[model samples]
Target: MKKKWLALLLGTSLALTACGSNDDDNAGKEPAENKETTTAGAGDAAKIYENKCSSCHAVNLEGGVGPNLTEVGSRLSKDEIEHVILNGQGGMPKELIVGDEASKVADWLSEHK
Candidate 1:
């Protein structure tokens, strides 16, 4: 019984750690060289999504741990998306990608519909 409890505790801890936000992925990395003339190009935004959101949201915007975002634009405006990104909603943690980057991502997502 004690061993079973210990195993359960260990598993829960690992699961929580995996789900927790990880903000250090790009801590020391330099900005990308490619800069689009537009406010937020598809390429740049997609890259950001891949780096910061793909784990839960999926690379194709299909549902994973998070809801499907394929038609998110039809459901929510850029401002709403930005608000969610900044403040988090439901199970999502806040400030995953703050500042201009968040805005850029919201803009890109707003075009999905």
Candidate 2:
């Protein structure tokens, strides 16, 4: 009957639409390796800065509540930068960044300077 055929067609269309939507959640997620790459290693230091330091230091590190981090390497050595990130200085709190992340950001700032 026409009613039966229309009902089947509508059901099939709904199922297909639901299946297509299921991928939307995963579309926003990077693969595991890419996620790790964004948070780890030499290349990811800028991403870490954007996540943590950009708020205070400004997107380009031109300074904000914190001092301009642009060319910070020229002002501080890598070890000094790492020490500050771990210990904090002045208005900044200690451990704004910690562990290997501290070292990576320090390395990045120093290199940019």
Candidate 3:
């Protein structure tokens, strides 16, 4: 076991040193590409909205269980959205999905609004 461990260590050490750290050099060399660009377009939030929030927001946000969220982005910041999502105000149902789940929903709402 000791010999095997030493051999593995030696093999990895040589392989690692042989590979230069060019990642940093190449990173900033190219003009920034649209990393956010998604070929599928938008995201699953749209579907989530249709399935979930639709009970309230009603797509265009004419009216529903909650007030119209069409202008939610203009009114609410990402942090506010997260807060509301986690802690629920008036009648939002405190911290539903949690963590990044709320963030994804916030971003989705922001885009539509």
TM-score of each: 0.63, 0.62, 0.53
Residues 1-113, model 3: lDDT tens digits: 99999999999999998895867766755443433222223546665456545666687665587888888888888778778877887756775545555677788777655
Q: After aligning candidate 3 to the native by TM-score, how far in Å is the CA of 112 from where it should be?
A: 4.0
TM-score of 2: 0.62
lDDT of 1 by residue, 2-68 (tens): 9999999999999999999887996875565433223344548888888788889999999799999
Task: Arrange candidates, best lDDT first.
Answer: 1, 2, 3
How high is the lDDT of residue 110 in model 3?
71
| TM-score preference between candidates 2 and 3, better one | 2
Superposed on all Cα atoms, model 1 deviates from the true structure by an RMSD in Å of 13.4
Off by over 4 Å in 1: 1-43
Question: Candidate 3 has which clashing residue pairs, if any?
Answer: 86-95
lDDT of 1: 0.86
Ten consecutive residues with minimal summed lDDT in candidate 1?
34-43
lDDT score of residue 63 within candidate 2: 91
At residue 101, candidate 1 shows an lDDT of 82
